[model samples]
Target: MKLIAFCSTGMRVAAVAAGIAVLTGCGSLPLPDKPQRPMVYDFGPGLPAASSGPAGAPLALAQVAAPAPLEGLAVNYRLLYAGSGQQPQPYALARWSMSPAQLVSQRLRETLAAQRPVVNVGESLAALELRVDLEEFSQVFDSPGASFGLVRMRATVVAPLTRGERLLGQRTFTARQPAASNDAPGGVKALTDATDDLARQIVAWLAELPVPQGARPVAPAARP
Candidate 1:
């Protein structure tokens, strides 16, 4: 009986030791790598604080409108080298922080604010309203090594009436800038440059437009 008991104790100790050894080996086994996150990009910090001076006519800016594809945050591009009929495609590993329309709208407001008091729709009574329709905004590749960013938009300025609004002026603005490289980052930079140029064009257009008769007068500034 003493011999049997001793053997049983020895077996239990060996079993415990084997179990610990298996657990240690499992812990040392390598784990699968984590999936990589997609890269996100946006128009870098916009222009510095606009200088304070005599503000231009108060202008209400409506939310920019875009097609279904541009309404998403995808960084879109086209490969002309692939085929002339090729459709635009979004980069798989890169995306914009906001939809193209939203980015353009933000850019417009920032740029326009420097020349005028840009406000949201219905924010300013009897103010001229600027509405933008974004038609095309993407990077187009001319060759495997060359590409350009294209931006096309239509803008309409309208003045308020007692019951509705009367159109003051309208124009289509298009701008394009060559990509520094044939990559997503290069495309984004080019797009930004095109947008800035488009904004300047709009400013010049607005300055040339004559205020129409029968339009409501600019609203008085509210006293703080």
Candidate 2:
């Protein structure tokens, strides 16, 4: 009887040890980590509806071209005091919905369409063309606490020809607006305001140009 009791006690101890070992192994396993999502931003202020303007041959607006740094969707900024030679750096957590060039082109097209007839590059038939080169679009920090949004672009008007496109006129536009704050949201607002001003200037410049031969002139009633 004594031997049998002793054997039973040993089995119970072994079972308890096995259960503890299993629990310890499970506790040592690592849990899966959660992924972080980036924030996306875009230009604000709703565009106005298209208004009646002078009847004319459809003008073509090409996609704006930008340098490699501005070509990406990332929101970029410059630390002027860090080093004049340093290239602009992008915010890791914030990004634009589209590239700066694309946004500018969209804004220009919408603004122009409201003033006159405009179409995409492929739709225009021997019509006047508008090409844009985006040189700068960034939030520049003059110091650790002060900053501004800067924008610069070159606009060229081209007359389509049987053989090649002829340059009719060209101009460069630059604008800077103080940021309400030193962060991405503030930069966006300033850049948007700058773009609005630039668009207005371009429209005024186009209004002064002589109507193309095939294009109809703006009626006095349609003139803004």
How many pairs of residues collide in each model? 0, 0
**Tens-digit lDDT track of model 1 for 126-188:** 358788999999999988889999999999888877666678888999999999989899999
1-224 per-residue lDDT for model 2 (tens digits): 99999999999999999878776886555567887666888776558785566455467787888988988988878999778526788877778888999899888888887877887665646357777899999989989898888999999887766555556799999989999999888888888888878888888887776645654222111111
lDDT of model 1, residue 50: 68
TM-score of 1: 0.80
Query: What lDDT does the true structure give each of the candidates?
Result: 0.85, 0.79
| Pairs clashing within candidate 1 | none
lDDT (C-alpha) at residue 78 in model 2? 90
| Candidate 2 lDDT score at position 52 | 63
Error of 1 at 42 (Å): 1.1
Collision pairs in model 2: none
Error of 2 at 130 (Å): 0.3
What C-alpha RMSD separates each model from the true structure? 5.8, 7.3
